[model samples]
Target chain A: MNPFSYARASDVADAIRQIAADPAARFVAGGTNLIDLMKYDVEHPARLIDISQLPLKSIEETPEGGLLIGAMVPNSDLAYHPLIEQRYPLLASAILAGASQQLRNMASTGGNLLQRTRCFYFYDVVTPCNKRKPGSGCSAISGVNRINAILGTSDACIATHPSDMCVALAALDARVHVAGPGGARTVAFPDFHRLPGATPERDTNLESDEIITGIEIPAKGFNANYSYLKIRDRLSYAFALVSVAAALELEGDTIKEARLALGGVAHKPWRDPAAEAAMRGQHAGESAFTKAADLLLQGAQGYGHNNFKIGLARRAIVRTLSQAARGMPQSQSVKKIR
Target chain B: MAQPGTAEPLRQTDVLPEKIQITLTVNGTRTGLAVAPWTTLLDALRDRLDLTGTKKGCDHGQCGACTVLVDGRRINSCLTLAVMKDGAEVTTVEGLASNGTLHPLQQAFIDHDAFQCGYCTSGQICSAAGLIAEGKARTADEIRELMSGNICRCGAYPNIVAAIQQAMERS
Candidate 1:
């Protein structure tokens, strides 16, 4: 690893000031992702501002009937919290489906959200990847395109964001709270991650000095019937080939509302407003779920090797939505609409 | 590729840099060390304290070859800074045995033939101990999920699972 100055911050304000003092400084919480990048020579920070001691590890009820999750809360703690398990089980399930127990115990919520993609080309110093080094080129476009993005991708980069928590958060309409030299501000979960446009290097909208303070998820009626389904080649510790996080609000037999997001298929959490719009006022059946899933995958473009991902993602979304709807205690047998 | 530990010293100052003083309680004994800030907990335990039970398969966090218990919770010590943990309790594979008697997990592992190369056995044993402490090995799926971080290149997952189950049954 590269040699750098390290300082443990006593408080959140001190940590913000430390990062603001140096543009090349980075805040280290879990060190699961950043430390690996540093060792691989992909990232070389001049200074490391350690904020693990900051009092940001809490989960509490907000004033607006929502849950406020502190940024420093470990993944294991969040996944096992009683309130989270009862109210938002999808979030708990999503966190559990990521990494492993050891990594979850050490990984923090803030660090998980800020994790970079696991693109093989991006990690290899010899390969050309725009996300790792701007303007070099993206070898993933033609090489090992199986795990590359099928939506919200550009010619410059085809990498997908490797996060399960963000997929659930995006579906649940969470808000990210950030604090920096300019004070505090809140960004909607969907707006937190930026698409790979001209600047593929920038993953999120956060500034260099900004620090994530907490995330707030508003209480919704559909959360009780939420589910997260991740489809991968192996069972555990592998990135999702295609994942779906969905919440269904059923008014007897009719669908009142639906929240859906797709992961491992886009540059960010692919939340489809059209799918949500189509699912409203429709009957809770296979046709409704399949139509909504088809609407979401309408614009997905697949490479030669990744053409199967489209079908796999479509099936995953349909299955997750059907499962969410079936949680409403109805013995209804619906035909397959695919 | 450069040799694992033979990369040219980035900073060529012969005089060792200023060392941060820290006291770590390993197993049950307290040991003090003055090490560089960049030194990881894995290197501190294996190189300085002579606790070589913690292996270093991948210096990065991709492999769980350096998993250790930090105050009863499992963490990748290769990714943790030694100076960050002060007066913290750490447990490695060497700490599992007591009075020349192997721990139940170790005994079960031997009986079940859980490892082949034995290079990743230390980390696997330490990680399994921490997993049981954290109540993570409840179901077979949970055991597989919790143990996914520790990879056995020899493909000894079935025997590893059996060893953990045997230890759980004994407990």
Candidate 2:
């Protein structure tokens, strides 16, 4: 890891000021991802501003009957929080489905959103990766792309975002609170992460000077009917190959509203409001679920190694929607298909 | 690729930033150490404080061999910088036992033969200690799921879960 100076921020303002002052400075909270990147020589921060001590670790109920989760809250704490588990169980299930207990304990809510892709070539540094070094060429495009993105992928990059929590957040329409040089602003979950248009280096819309303060989930949490299904090589401690976050608000056996998001399939948590709308007012059954799945997988392009992901993602969507419709959210502790 | 712990141009800085002074209450011993900002807590424990009980299996967060309690919460010490934990209380495997009496989890691991090679035992015990404190994992499946972070390449998972269950009962 490259040597860097350490500065502990006294407050959020101090953190914003420090990061805004230095373009290369990074805010280190829950040093799970950034430290790993630094160790891999992927990131080189001139200074590490310790923002873990900042006053942002609370999970409070919003006036709008939603939950406002501080960025500093550990992934474990957030997943186990009473309000989160009761109201936003989709988010809870998604969080629990990711990484492991130890990693979730160290990973923060804010840092999880900004985590880099787990692309092999990107981390190898020796290999040619457009995300790692733009214009060097994307090795995953022709190389081993078993885990590359299928939707919204540019020719320059095909890396998928590896966050399960963000997938749920995208489905739930969570708003991200950020403090930057431009002052404080809220970014909607879909707008937070960016597609690898031509610049694969930039993963998020969040500027280098900005510090994410908290994430706010609205009142409609889809708590009654939600399921997070992550299919991976291993049952646990593995990244998802095709993960779906399905949530529905049903009127009897009819779907009143629906939200669907996919992880490990695109640069960001893949969501289609149109596909979700396709399920609205439809009976909560295979027919409606298949319609949504077909619409969601529309125009999904897959590389050689990951060609099966398109079909796999389609099946996963239907299965996840079925699970959500029955209020039988997939258990994170249990690996049972039901 | 540069593996962990092979000192290759690990200077303080390109501009030579000074070492950061931090205080850590490790297993009740309050110690002061001036370390580089990039020095991981695992390295600080083994190389500086000589707390070799906490093993460094992957040096990355992939493996939980460097698991330790930072302010009573279990985390990957390898991924955590010592400087980031400025005034924190860290408990390693060496700290788990007191008055020469092994912790319940430590004792249970031995009784259940939870380990073949003992490389990952310390981390498993420390992680189990944290798991018990959390009071979440009740069933064997829950223990297996929660303890998935600590990988035992020796295939001692059945016994490891059993040992954790025993320790949870004692706690």
Candidate 3:
């Protein structure tokens, strides 16, 4: 890794001021992803503002009966938090289904949201990647792209967002609280991450001077019946090929409401209102689930090697919804990989 | 591609930054050290502090050979910067045995022959030690799933699982 000046921020204001001073400066909370990218020469920040010491490691209950997760809270702690496990079990399961025990211990909730895609070409400095180098072109477009995106992909890039927690957050209608040079603001979960449009270099809509403070999960009725299913090449320690986060509110036999999001299939968590709308007032069964899945994958187009992801994602959506509808425990059904 | 640990050409600058001082309790010893901003915790332990029990396999955090406990939680030391962990407690494999007496997990690994080449033994033992402390894994499947970060190419997983189970039962 290249040498850089490191400074520990005293608070959020100090962090924002420090980062705003240098364009090449970045905030390092967990260093799980940033340090790895530095080793691979994918990132070379001139200055690192260490925000790990800041007091953002709380898991508090909002007055509206929702959970407010601090950005610096470790993934392991957040996953096993009594409030999260009891109320937002989908988020807990999604967190557990992403990384191994060791990585989860080191990863922070905010850092997990900012994790880059595991696209092989993106990591290999020799290859051409639009995300890595603005106009270099995407090698994955014509190379091995079994893990690339199948939805919300652009001609410039085909990378998928490699986050299970973000998928669950999108399903639960979570909002992101950000502190920046301007001031503090909240961004909807779906809008926080950006699609790979012409500017594939920008992974998120967050400004360069902004730092994520916390993630606010609104009290949802789907916590009782939600499932996070991740399918991967291995049973553990690998990235997801296709993962589904499904939550349903059932009124007896008919679906009163539905919340759905997909990971490893799009630049961001793929959530379509039409697909979620198809689940409302529909009977909970294989037919209705399949119909919703088809609606979810309607406009999904895939690259050469990753074309199979569309089918895999459709099946995953159906299976995840079925599990959620039955309130079946999401244990060992999906694998955790980081 | 330059693999990690290779010395890279330093960029020419007018002024060089000063090393950052950090205090850490290794095993049971509280030590203070100054490290460069680029130095990883794994490098500080192995090169600076002369603790080589922690192997550096895949320094990019892909392999768990560099696993260690920071504040009693298992993490990839290779992925953590030394300067970031200013006043934390770190436990390496060398810290497992105290007063010439091996930890129960270490003894269990030896008794069950949980290692062949032994390249990944230290990491496996440390990770299992953390797992036991967490008190989450109850069954063999849970053990295997939780220990997936530490990869043993020699295929010593069954014996490792058995050893961990024995240690769990004893504890």
* Candidate 1 regions with alpha-carbon error over 4 angstroms: A221-223, A328-338, B1-17
Residue-level lDDT for A185 in candidate 1: 97
Candidate 3 ranges beyond 4 A from true positions:
A333-338, B1-12
lDDT over C-alpha atoms for residue A318 of model 2: 95
Q: Indicate the worst ten consecutive residues by lDDT in candidate 2 chain A.
A: A125-134
Q: Could you give candidate 2's per-residue lDDT for residues B21-134 as a string of tens digits?
A: 899999999999999988999999999999999999998887788999999999999999999888999999999888999999999999999999999989999999989988
Q: Give the Cα lDDT of each candidate.
A: 0.85, 0.91, 0.89
Cα distance off (Å), candidate 2, residue A205: 0.6
B9 Cα displacement, candidate 1 (Å): 13
Q: Write the per-residue lDDT of candidate 1 for residues A206-277, one digit (tens) a residue.
A: 998899999999987265577788877776778999988989888897888899999999889999799999
Better of 2 and 3 by lDDT: 2
- Top DockQ prediction, candidate number: 2
* Per-residue alpha-carbon lDDT of candidate 1 for residues B1-171, written as tens digits (9 for 90 to 100): 333222223433345447789999999999999978788999999999999989999887667889999999888999888888878999998898999999999999999999999988988888898888877457766787788889999999999999999998887
Ranking by TM-score: 2, 3, 1
TM-score of chain B of each: 0.89, 0.92, 0.92
Q: What is the lDDT of residue A69 in candidate 2?
A: 93
1 or 3, greater by DockQ = 3
Q: Which ten residues in a row have the lowest lDDT in candidate 3 chain B?
A: B1-10
